[model samples]
Target: DPRSRDENGLAPIVWKREKMIPYVPTPIVYGGYLFDWSDEGIVNCVDLKTGKDVWVKRLSEGGKYSGSLLCIDGKIYGVEEGGTVTVIEAGPEFKELGTADLGDASYSTPAVANGRLYLRTFSRLKCLPAKKS
Candidate 1:
C-alpha cells in the first residue's frame, strides 16, 4: 500500500521471475544482460527485457565463490573463493576466454581504474597493469 507508512506501506513489486539468480556478491549488468553466478560456479546470463536466460555455463567443478563478478572491456571476470579467476566473453554465447589462479583465497570483488586491475585476497592485494597496445 503506497498510502501508508512503514513496511506495510511499501510499493508493490512490479514483476517477479521464477528463475534463480545469485543473492550473494551481487550481480552486474551490461549490454542489456544480467550476469550472475551461484556459489558452486554456475554462471547465468539473462536477457533484461524478457527475463529469459541467454546462456548458463559451469565455470568450475565445485568452487565456492565469495566475490562478485566484474565486467569490463567486453569481458566478465569472476573469481572463485579459491582465488581462481575465470574470464568470459560478454555476449549471448558462453565463451570462457581463460582462467588464472591467484594462489590464495579471495573474498573481495575486483576493481579496475587507471588502466589497472586490483584484486584483494585473504592475505594480500594483487594489481595487474593493462597491457600496452
Candidate 2:
C-alpha cells in the first residue's frame, strides 16, 4: 500500500514487491539504482528505472539486521544486530571494503549527517568520524 497522500489523497505506485522481509528495509537511491537491505542482512541492488533486481549479496551472519543500510562514498554500510558493521562497494559486484566491531548490541537505525556516521547501541550512542583525506 502506498503511503503518500496529497490534497487529493492519492499516491503514485512507484514500485511493488510480492515478498519482502518482515523488517524495516530502507531503500537508498544512488547512481541510478536503489539499494535495499533485507531483514536477514542481504543487500540487493535494483535498477531504479525499472525496479528490477540487478544483484544481491549476503552481508552478515548469526544475527538479523535491523538498522537501515547507509551508502557513503560509493560504499554500503550494514550494521547487524550483533554490532558488526560490514562495509561493501555500492554496485552489482559484491566487493567488501571492511568490517568493524562496534562492541555492542543494537536494533536501531543509523544516521549520517554532517559527514559523520552515528550509531545507537543498546547502552550508548557512538559517533564515527567521517572519512578523511
Candidate 3:
C-alpha cells in the first residue's frame, strides 16, 4: 500500500500498485474507481479501494502521448501528439466511440466548460459547438 504521512503526522492511506507508469493526466476518480492514462498511452481503470487495475487499454501503438485526458458523461477522451482525438466509452471493455482530426500540432489540453469544448493548436484556437443531442 502506498501510504503518506499527512501534515498532522497521521498516515493517509493510499492504494498501491506496481509497474504503473504515471501519465500526464491526473487520475480521475468516479464511482469507486481511479482512472489513469500511463505515459505510454495505456488507459487503466483501477479499483479505488484496492488499487488494483480493473481494466487496461492501449490507445495507440506506442504513440507519443502528451495531452491530458477528459472524462465526461461516462466517456473518456484522449488526445495524442499526432492531432488525433479519440473518444472511448469508460468501462472494463475498451469501446471506441469516435475520433476526429485536430488538424495541427497541439500540446495544450482540451477544455470543457459550459458544455463547450475548446482546443488550441500552435497558433489557432478552435471552439467546438456543444449541444446535448
lDDT of each: 0.81, 0.78, 0.74
How well does each candidate superpose onto the true structure, as a TM-score? 0.83, 0.80, 0.81
Q: Across residues 29-132, which tens digit of lDDT does each residue of candidate 3 receive?
A: 76777778776778888888778888888875446567777777888776777677777777766677887888887776788898788877777888886546
Q: Model 2, 48-96: lDDT tens per residue?
A: 7678888877764535887787888898787888888888888767677
Model 1 — which ten-residue stretch has the worst lDDT?
Answer: 12-21
Better of 2 and 3 by TM-score: 3
Of 1 and 2, which scores higher on TM-score? 1
> How high is the lDDT of residue 49 in model 1?
73
Descending-lDDT candidate ranking:
1, 2, 3
Deviation of model 1 at 120, angstroms: 0.8
Candidate 1 regions off by >4 Å?
1-15
Ranking by TM-score: 1, 3, 2
lDDT string for model 1 (25-124, tens) is 6878889888877777888888977667888888854588878888888898888888898888888898989899899998778899999889888999
What TM-score does candidate 2 reach? Answer: 0.80
- Please give the distance, in angstroms, between residue 81's alpha carbon in candidate 2 and its true position after superposition: 0.5
Alpha carbon RMSD to native, model 1 = 4.0
Candidate 1 positional error at 50, Å: 0.4
